[model samples]
Each structure stands twice: as structure tokens, then as C-alpha cells.
Target: MIAQSAARHYANFKGLPKGRSELEESSLMARSTTLAFSGLLLAAAPASALARDYLVHDQKEYRAAAGAVKAGDVIRLAEGEWKDFPILLEGQGTAKQPITLTVQTKGKVILTGASSLRMAGSHLLVSGLVFRDGSAPGAEVISFRRDPRSYARHSRLTEVVIDRYNKADRRTEDRWVSIYGSDNRVDHSWFAGKGNLGVTLAVIRPKGQPEANRHRIDHNYFGPRPPLGSNGGETIRLGTSDESLSDSANLVEANVFDRCDGEVEIVSVKSGANVVRSNLILESQGAIVLRHGNGNRVERNVFLGKAKPHTGGVRVINEGQIVRDNYMEGLAGTDFTSALAVMNGVPGSAINRYHAVSGAEIANNSMFEVARVTLGAGADAERTAAPTGSRLTNNLITGQDGKPFRVEADMVGVTFTDNVTDGEVPGAIPSGLRKTGIATKRAANGLLYPTDPALAAQGAPRDLRPVMVAEVGPAWYPKATGIAAFGSGRAVPVKAGGLEAAVAAARPGDTLKLAAGHYTAEAPLRISVPLTVSGPRDADIAFSAPTLFQLEEGAALRLEGLSITGDKAPRQSGNAVIRTSALSTVANYALEIDGTAFSRLDSAPAFDLIATTPGTFADRIAITKAAVNGLSGAVLAAAAETEGKGRYAAEHIAIADSRFEKIGSLAQILRAGTDESTFGPELILRGNTVVQSGPVMLGLSGVQSILIEGNTFRSSGRIAVANSVGTPETRIIDNHFIQTPEPTVTKLYPQGSPRVLVSGNSIGGDAS
Candidate 1:
């Protein structure tokens, strides 16, 4: 029934069917009746008996009227583009007469360009709004709770659409929808294309509060989220690790999570007493982890992996968590990050660390084609404490994989009973476990059930109850039999005269296939949307201009199977072939150059890649399977233009499986942040060959973790790696340095920074 309401809310607009149009003539009276019927229901009164109605044509009028809105008042936004408008709604209405904010003509009022809404006060309803083609810098697109004031109580946000709201660097913390306060509901909304940082929706528990937030997030569509490659990217997070002990009493039911593989722990339940039931989690990379808190219930959910690697199932931790009646099919994860992982807790763990799983009940669940199920995972080293007083009973597991279960040595005080598995169960399994074969088939009600009457009667049914593929995403998504709606878009082919023209004419998800020939760019190409430009191995791009590419805000550039070379321009000074500026309005940007080459750049200090926007930053930059040779300057130079208090920060820079030869000064090979700001905690230089003539191969400051492994460095330099500020962990291991100078790796501020271990490297004949 709740799902039906969500469907109705999404299909609320009259004469506005998606992707098509039909002109329908109606009298003024009929139009008025339709408009009034869409208004807020006041005290169970009929639509004609509403107190007052105000038509706001623009943001200016909307703002003015929003300040003075009263109970039983309905404000209708006129049809047009409301760009970068920040709406702060504050009103108090009785349950009988709630305040409403809606559109006059649905699907016609488009909100773009950093537009957002912050709802305050109680008994408020915001519905039938569309937010797309924009991003909110350092904030959520729609927030029901603001800092220092949680005013949204008994509020509802329905029929809302937040699509493609992203940041510039993809590292800044933000969300699409943040629900706070008690008795609030977010239903039937659609959230798609949140490729950057932050969750799609988060239910935050206010600090120092004992009462649970009691929010209901149901029937919403959580769409595709690309892997963020770090922590803090989840589809739905109930609470943070800090508030793990707080009872949220949140109910997340009947929602569809489609390909939401943003990071590990997809639907993270960090709080206690929450219920995650009857939902469909499809092909996501992470499982629904009970990371913290206690007494949580995870039941009746469907997890479909379809044989993808890292696709997960329930991962249990903490205490008093129940996992039952769930169906997992074609899951591939094993070991600690396995299909059914009952993690080994750390002894005397704090609130933030992994706590022991006590009083857990894994009962009556069905697993098909799972790689491995385990208990006491990660108990060997990190998580040394075993779970206590846990029961695994009456679960039916059948697969061809021989290794069905792996119980670690340290696991003790576990009771496994009546669990039937047809595969080769481990020898250490408890005594009462049985090996049985169960027959199953699809029943008339569209659910898989055990055909054998005895198996069905024993409550140990073995059935891979697959979710209807057509019923998987947003309610209004076009139904295709046996197709997942979240993974349904196809890239259109684009052909143009030049790269810049192709990028300008192409849509967000279009692919431009370049022919195998040399292409020249007179001016730098500006990219403001996510695009993929690929070609054959023989294709190349030559840059005559000072800068070859200029990435704007919200742009993601991927270049593969191509070579990029710089022309010999003598007059060019202190410029790069590819550069980024801080003047962009968008927050996050991505640049991926793979299987490419950069050579013959004769300019003085020829910086091949320069990302130095003073106040702006990029999320990820990856250069792999490429070669950099015959360059006078550093191959990669990234730093904030301005020094001191205004430096840009980039995250996740990976240069792997590549070759660097005949480079200018080894000191200039890789220059990460300036003396002021830090680049990232993760800078990976692995499986590469670097041959330089100068003193240094890498220089960094204010970094966190640097991995320099499995590389051959042939240099006469003084230092292989140099750091100014003290980093936490720098591993210079497993590298062969030939004909190197005095110091292999040096840390300038050795006292402040931790020591960089220069071991496992055959430097100048002996391991250094």
C-alpha cells in the first residue's frame, strides 16, 4: 500500500507523461478543480474549502510569500526554471491544517543550478518538485534538519526528484537528502546519479539526544552510485559511528537499492533498534552491515549479486542483531567480507571500533550459489576476539562450492543447529548440523518456495526467491522484462569535426569514438559534463596550444587507448599541456588517462599535468598503463596556486603500471601539494619504472599515506622520495634502485612525521 502511494505521487502530474506530450483542452473550471485537488489537505476538508492560495511565479515572490505563509496556506510555484534558488521553508501548522509547498504545473518547474530546500517547522508537506542539472556546494539538496536547530517534525517530503546533484572534487561531504527529527517520512522520491561523495540519503541522530529520530524512509528509488573509492559513500546510512548506541527506531522498508555500489556498507545501520525489512538490494558492491549498535532486525530482504565480484550479503557485527528470512543468490564474496560474515570483534572495543557480536540469531535464511559463509572472520590478527552466545540455526544453504563454511580457530561459544547444507561443510562444524537436499520451484504468487511438503513444514525452506526484475527501481521507471531499471541507460554515439565540438554537442552519457589518426587542438577543450573519449591504439592528440584541456565544474574526463604529445613551442613558459582552474562553479571533477603516452614536450619545466586551482579541488586523477618520456619538467604537478590558508586539496591519485623515462630533473617527476596544503592520504605509485637524471623522483608535503612499491628506479638522485611534513605512513618497500645516490628516501621534518620505512629495496647492491 505504501508503495502504491509512492507510485501515485510520482505519477501525480496530469497531462505530463514522461518522454511524451499530448495537448489536452480543459475549461478554466476544470483546471481550477485539478489545481485545487492537488493542494494540501487541510483538516480533512475538501479541496474547494482550502483557506488561501498564493501563486509564486519567480523565486523572488516565492521567498517573500514563504516568510509569511500560515496554516492552511498552499504556495504554488509557477512553471519555469528556478536556478540556484535556496528555499528555506519555516512554518508551523496543526495536524488538521498543514502547510504545503508544491508546483502549479508538475514537471514544468525545473530546479537547476545549485538550488536546494531546507524544511523547518512541523506538519509541513513538500511534494511534486523536480531538482536536476545542478549541485549544492557543501550541503544537501534537500535537508529537513539544519545544524543547531532540528525544526522538521512530523514533516513529509514526497514526489521529489534529486538527479545529478554533485560537487566539484567529489570529496566534499554532502548528501542529496538528509532527514532529521522525529515522525518524519521521505517516501516515493527518486535519487539518481550521485557519483561523488556523501550518501544519497542519511538519517542523522542529533548529538546528546536520547530519543530515537523515528524516521520512515520507504518506497524510494536509490539509483546507481559509482564507487567513490573511499569511505563515507553509502546509499543510506541511519547513523554515524559516534551515535551508534543511540536508538534510532528507524524503519527502512520496501525501498529498492539498485546498483548502489558507492562503497562498502551500502545500507549502514549504525544505530540500534532499527528495522530493515522487505527491501530489494540488487547487485551492489557492499552488504547491509550492522556495524554498530544492538537489537537491530534485518529480515525478509532480497540480495541478488548475479556473480559479480565484491557483491556482498549480510555482514553481522555488534550485538543482539537478527538476520532471518533473507534470500541471497549468486553472491561471490568470501572470507571476512563474505556472503554471511559474522565478524570477529575486537576485545575491549570502543564505540568506533568493531564490537563483539553477541546474541546474534542467523535463522531460516536461504542462500544459493554463495562463495563462502564464515564465522569469526578477521579473527587471526586485527579482530582477535571471538563472538559469544551466537546461534546459527535452521538455515538452508545449497551450492556446488565445496567450501561452504569456514569457522576460525578462535571462534568459541557458538551454537549451530539444524542448519542443512548440501555442499562440503567444514570439519569443525558443530555436531547437530545436517546435510540435506531441498527441492524448490516458483509458486503461483511469483515467489520461490520449497516443493517438498516436509521441507516446507519444517520452516527450513531453500529457495532463491528472486525479486521481479521489472519491479526494481523508481516506480515510474519503464518496465522491461528481466532487466534491472537502474542499469538501463545506453550511451549514444557522437561524431563531430573536432574533440571540443564533439564534447559540446554530446549529452552527459554520450561516448565519442575517435578515429585512428593524429588530431590537433588549436585551443584548449572545455569539458563541463561527464564524457568518455576513446580511440584505437594508433590514435593520438597533439596540443599546439599552451593548455590542451580545461576541465570545468562537474566534469569527468576519461581518455583511453590514445597518446597525447606536446608541440615544441619555445615561447611557452611556466604552462602545462593540461590545466585546471578554480573559477569553475561546480565542485567535483575527475580525470582519467589510461593506456596513453606523453612525449617530446620541449618547453622549459614542461609540466604535463597541472591541477592547481587555488580554492578548488578534484576528486580523483588516475594515469595508468601509460608512458611519460622526454619531458623537461615534472610529469605531474599539482598544488594550490595561492599559498597559506587558501590551498586546494585533491584525493586518490594513482599512477600505476606505467613507465617514465628520460625525464628532466628527478625532483620534478611528481610534485604534489605546495608547502602549504596537502594533496591526499592516498597516493599510489606502484608497478612502474622511473629513470631520471636529477636528484629526486617524488616530492610531497602534508600527505597521509604514500605507497611506493614494486618499481625500478634508475636514478643518480639524492633522494627517491622526499616529504616536508610528517606523514602518518609511508611505505617504500619492494623496489629495486640501481645506481642511486646517497639517501634513498628522506623526510625533511623527521621529528614531526613518522619514519618512512626504506626496506626490501636493493639500493646500490644492498637492501636499504
Candidate 2:
């Protein structure tokens, strides 16, 4: 009975559903009679009979020409290999008569399967086919699942080439491509050793469902991956399962991933909007990570490989993600090992987790030459602690002797201006060199005219004086204003003061204006070249010597204005401070607090200024229009630990219109060590004024593009913007905090932080 005439010819082919299932018919003359019967079979054939040339030598002539395809057909595939069974081509085209299954010539067409090549409905178009050896470890070489006796909704897999067909030692199996359903278009395909992700768009039952969302993955080329499924290098992945079922919208452009293994996630979304741009990633190991989808947009794109230092280059745990102008180079492997990392209130939540990445803008793009940590813990912890506040303007990082590597990492509310670094000047890793002023004599243009040709070519060792000029005042003599006079050699006298008593002695670079009456000195004025030691405006410059300003180890000090104070020892904490010693380059260290004030200097129990070495030359500290009334233990402390490396290395610094009222215990501004190089250890605290400085004003440990604009802090001290350091690039813009808060008032310790851009700030604290 031949199964009762094949069930009466499948019930007359299910009442002639025509092609592309008539775009799911919904009446209207049955979709205009299925687009007038596929436009009368392509206007009455002939163009090689409407191009339907199938030649699959086995599997029963490929399911008998896919049940004799009709509606505007174009199934071509004639030059070779075929093994895995089902090519169930649910043929039914009508959205302008669709149905194109191509691969006419370019040889090698192997679609070996246990269950794939399953196109279940709607305007199908599977182009340039090449599905190889399929091992079906679980199946899905090419799918479009959404069947309930379906009538094709919307299918398309262009340039289709699902490689290694089923994997049976085709060099260790693994190839997958799975699409749920909804206006699909997977263009220019070529997916090698796949699945667990080479291409995936999951959403299998999450309740109310319905929103497989429109899709379009452009310019495909996802190679390499199978050495260990899902390593997270990401070639393409949207929807990793949060199960509320809203696969909303999609569109990934310009694709080109070399060794994708994992981490390009995009889970939960109650809304829609996706657009990943440019694209050109190589050496794949880890990158392109995003989660908890929300109006997404990642721009430019050019990431180069070998991730896993917590795999960076892209990591946004979702909250309105929008990282711009991307260009990530690699270097994040020190091997501490954490495995499958997914931070931010963790769980089995694999990736894309965001509720606060709000409106991102990581601009510019130029992580050049990346790779400084040569053989474990080098370049001092990746230039001090990488990532903070996102916007990090105009980047151009370089540092492997080529010079320019100074970033301590905690960039709060980031907005660093015009950064530039030429490289290699950061020394002190079991190293020491600090002695300026060596002139034995000899130069008629023999090059060592030391005493300043900018310190004579840096190697320093020159001698030859005839350019005398050291008088101090006439605008403090340096060629009497024509510049070039930095301690001109050959004039060794003072030990008893004579030239008008050493011109009222107070050396350094020499600038003792004085004048408004009130002068007392006990012996503390030992600087070498950079000095301001001001007075003149209603004068008062007294130092009963307990330690007023003694910096001797290649000093570069600046102490504007002045006001004296008497006895204070434990080693003279800080009243009129500026000291350097122990191997130095006081690196443009400025502490100008114009109104000039400070009491007891932490009652003299020791440190107020220790000079921890960490330099690339940008800024270490600059308190402008100053005022620090009564400090104890910490008005400013820059710790340089020195282990693997990287904490705070000077770069571009600015501390605006300062004023720290009652300081006790610690921190008005303090930066700890670990900088290798990036030249952005920037700090700009505008219109500053801190009432009770102790619960932190700036405690950055791994600081970066820091800029806390429009400052105002009242009575604070417990982590008031502390740099927790796992990775902090902070940016706390337009700031203002009152009543001295922080009984755990969130200032930042957000796990492995890299980008923090808190817009236009204002907090209330003081409830503890």
C-alpha cells in the first residue's frame, strides 16, 4: 500500500503551502495565493529551469531533491562530499518568492550529520554550503528550531559553511551554529571547529518568550577553537541564558575573529538594541566580554590576543553598555589563576551582567605595543593597576625602555587631559642613582658643559665655568631673568656666610624674598636647585629650626608663600616642608597652598614627606592656592612599595585651589606604589576645601586618569574615595560631598574595577 500512498501525498503537500510557507500565510487571499504560486515558478521556468540543480550522490538523492523544491527555488550544490543525513529543507518561500540553497561550484561540500541542516520554515536561503564530517556530539551544524508543525517564519544562513561537519577526530571535533528563529541573516559564513560557541543565539523556553528578535551577523569569519570548549575569546554570542526570554534585537558587524574560545556574552535584556562595530581580533584567548544587555554599542574594534589576567580588553557587566572607539592590544597574564571569571555579585551567571555601566564612552583607542610584564610581575603591575573611569582621553601608551609608563590605576571619575609619554625614565627596581652637581672642568664645546645643558645630556660630568650669576633677587638672578643660571659652577665659599651673610642664606635654587617683617632661622634650609621659599606679601618667614625645609638628594622643591612655627621634633613633621633625600628626582613635586598654614605638622612623630620613588614624569602632587592648617601624620604621603611593581608613578598632576582645614590621622592626598608606565597618573582636584581631613580625600593606591572636578569635602575619613586596587580607573566628575561622610558610604571597591565614571557628583554622608 506504500504507506497508503504516502499518506495521500502528504495530504496534497499540506494543501499546497507553496514556497517559503507563503510567508506564513495569514490569509489575504492566502498571501496572494502564495505570491501567485512563487511568481508562476519564476515566470514559467528556463534560466536553466529556474535554477534547481541538485546532485548529491547519496542519502537517497538527498531526500529526493528535498521533496522536489518549488516556490522560487534555487538549490545548487553540485561539486562533492556528503554524509550526515537530514537536509529537511522545510521549503516554503514567498516574501517575494525566497528559497535559495546554494553552493554551485567552489568544491568541498561536506554536510555529514546525525541531525543538522534543519531549516524549519520561512523564506529560507542557505548559501555557499560546506558542512563537514559532523560528529554530532550533541548536534546542530546548522539549525533554525521553532517547530510545532511550523510553516517557516524567517530563515537565512548565507555563505553557509559549517566545518568539520560532525567531528570525529577531524582534529578533535567541535563545530556548531545554532539560531532560534526570527528574521535571520547569517552572512558570509565560515565557522571552524565550533560550538559552545562559534555562533550561538540561545533562548530555549524562558516563559512568555516571543522575541527571538531580528538578527544579522555580518561579514563572518570565526576560526580556531576546540582546545577546550568555551574559553571565552568570542566570535559571536548573544543570550547566554537569564531565561526571561527576550532575545530582543541583534546586529554584529565587520566580524573577523581568529581563535575564539569564549567570553562575548550578552544575556538578560527586558529591552532591545545591539551593535558591535568594526572588528578584527587575533590570537584569541579572551576578549569582547559583556553582560546583562541594554542598548548596547561597542565601537571601532581591533583587539590582539592572549588574554587571562582576568582577561581584559572588554569587560562590561551590563547596565546600559556603550564602550566606544575600541582598540585593545594584549598583556594580562601574570598567572595567579582564577578561572572562568565573572565578577559583580557572582553566581552561575556566566557573562553579560550589568545594572550599572550606565552610558559608557571609553574613547580614543591606542593601546600600542602592549606587553611590558616580561616574565612575571614586570612593568610594575601593568603600569600600576590598569583601568578606571572609562573616558581616559587620547591614549598612547608605551613603555619597554621606549619610555613613558606611569599610571597608578585608581582613576576616580576619570577625565585625564592631553596625555603624552616618550618612555624610559622610570628607575628604582633594585636600582639607585641620585647625585646632581658634578663639574671637574673641561669644555670648549667638548660637550660636557655641565651645570645645565639640561644637566648636560643626562650622564652628567662636565666642567667649565665663565658664566657667573648668582645673586638672588633682581627677580632672583638666573641670568637675572634670562633663565640659564641653575647653580653655575665654581663659587665655593659659605660656611660662615659673607656676601652679605650669604645673601641672607636659604639656598636650594635660591629665592628668599622675605620683607614684610618676621624672620627667624635656626638652621634648616638645605635644598639643591628648585626653590620658591616665598615671603614678600606682608612677610613672615620664620623657622626656629626643628626642621623647616631640608631636601638634599637631588632636590626639586617648591614652597610658595610662608608662615613660621617653633619647635617640633620627632624629626620636624611639616610646617614649611619640602624634603627629598634617599635617591631622588623630586619630580616637579609642587605643594603650593597660597594662604599657607599648618599646625604642629602631625605633632612630629615622624613622616609628613618621605619621597617614595616612582616616576615617569607627569605629576606627583600639586596643591594650588594652598592652605593646610594643622596636619598630623598625613597631609600627603606617596608610598612606593616595590614588589612585582606598580602603584603610583608621576605623570600629569594638578591639585587646585587647595585648603585642608583640620587634618588629623591621615590622607588629604596620598598615592601608594606600583607604576610601570602609561603616563596618566593624573589628578585634578578643583577648588578644594576639606574641613576634617582623615577619612580620605585622595588615598589612591593604584591610581590612573584621576580627576575629581569641583571639589568640596567636609569632615571625612573612612575610605572617602579609597582606591581598593584590583584595577581602578576612577572618574568622579563634578564633585561635592558634605558633613564628612563614609561609614561605608560607597566610594569605590567594586571588585576588579577598571572603568568608573560617576557623573556630576553630590553625596550627603554623616549619619554614622
TM-scores of all predicted structures: 0.70, 0.26
Report the C-alpha displacement of residue 721, candidate 1, in angstroms.
Answer: 13
**Candidate 2 Cα errors over 4 Å, as ranges:** 1-98, 101-118, 121-143, 147-156, 159-185, 188-235, 238-710, 715-726, 729-768
Pairs with steric clashes in candidate 1: 43-96, 167-587, 167-588, 168-587, 168-588, 168-589, 169-587, 169-588, 666-696, 726-753
Give the per-residue lDDT digits (tens) of candidate 1, residues 1-768. Answer: 222232233223212121101111111222332234343333223423655677899888998889888876778889988898888888986554567888877677888998889988887778768887878744788888655565688777866778767775555678898887877877667777775667789987767765787777766777777555445668999987788887888877667787776666788898999888767877777788898889898877787788765577888999899998787777776654467988887788888878988999999887777787877765634467788898988787766375678776455567888777767767677464677776778665344556767567333233323334343333444321221211123454433346767767766645677887777777778776667778776677876677777777656677777777776433566656667764633345667878878777655565555544543455677888988777766666664433333133455678889888877543232333323112243578889887764555566554555787897778645445555442235787888878765344555443233447777877675322
What is candidate 2's lDDT per residue for 85-106, written digit by digit as tens?
5666877765444565655464
How many clashes (backbone N, Cα, C below 3 Å) per candidate?
A: 10, 85
User: Relative to the unseen true structure, what is the C-alpha lDDT of residue 613 in candidate 1, on a scale of 0 to 100?
Assistant: 54
Error of 2 at 234 (Å): 7.6
